[model samples]
Target: MPEADGAGEQVGVGPWSGGSPPDDPRYDPELLAHGDRRNVVDRYRYWTVEAIRADLDARRPPDRHLHVAIENWAHDLNIGSVVRTANAFNAAGVHIVGRRRWNRRGAMVTDRYLHLHHHPDPAAFAAWAAHADDGARLPVVGVDNVPGSVPLEGRELPARCVLLLGQESSGLTPEAQAACDVVVHITQHGSTRSLNAGAAAAVAMHSWALQHA
Candidate 1:
């Protein structure tokens, strides 16, 4: 694993060496020659960006049920981190409600590998979920510590559902809370009032994966 520099930025590795190019169509010629240190797994090293995407798409389980969504009303920097986590978990896709443009620095370029959807607001997102072709309605599960939220532990997160999170400063908006099928809160032992949106998103996604992945 590469170490982060003093500024907390990872130094990328250089190109591969001591070998001739393999004949696999999946490998990117430039990456093979230059080396590939992208945040991808070893299985994807030196693979073309499109090839990786196509392979993941083809191999992805048909029942990929967990979708992650973020309320992006404030251009929240945490949105990028949530995107990165979604990619890590191989989520079906990410939905950004509100601002379309978000800071991608925290994504570390992983957004190129993940499916992203945009909605003008929560209502549009809710409408889409309500109409999903699945026999059961896809639930919009909200993550927050707001009053009346159920504890997340042992809660049966639906297999076909979207995990919704709010912005960094403010939690879910009243409209968003109203839109959720159920709001669940992560149990915390420390003094902090709540987890940041990105961390909350990761925990929520992992919870779903634990139940249904």
Candidate 2:
């Protein structure tokens, strides 16, 4: 860079000049091409999307997965929080069952790396999971505090499975409730009837990531 001197002569700019590109590798070129103000960590400052995905693909273990599923009964705010949480956990994908559109405000730009899928109903989610791993038969795990549920800590989660979460006020519906191969619950010490949908989704996703990822 250069600067103009008093006599209009070109002077070289000093090193103190505040202009430098980011050094992170995960940053997408598309983002850089546009400006590179993404919400990703510093490690992914200025890079191309293809470059980041290629790097992750090379380093990620084949069996490591963090799948998050949310039942969008009426487009709740918890859905956005859940998506953000799944992104934090580096989930393999996000399954949204219900309304085709969801609020992206709470995602905080994390949705870029997180894969999202839409399903009209629980059956559709199940169908995708059934053939998830090239027809290898993956389990669809559900999270709820129902009587017949299992403790997430005591069991191991599969790498390629759907972890389903119900709506906020009303948990999973009859059909949705019965579609789980296994249901897990988060231990609550308070008088609340159950945990918030977003909180429960985070806990379940973390537990599953610990076991499988």
Candidate with best lDDT? 1
TM-score of each: 0.89, 0.80
Q: What is each predicted model's overall lDDT from 0 to 1?
A: 0.83, 0.73
Model 2, TM vs. native: 0.80
Model 1 quality (TM-score)? 0.89
Residue 76 lDDT (model 2): 84
Residue pairs clashing, model 1: 15-34, 15-35, 16-35
| Lowest lDDT block of 10, candidate 2 | 10-19
* Candidate 1 residue lDDT tens string, 134-186: 64567899999999999999999887788889989998999999999999999
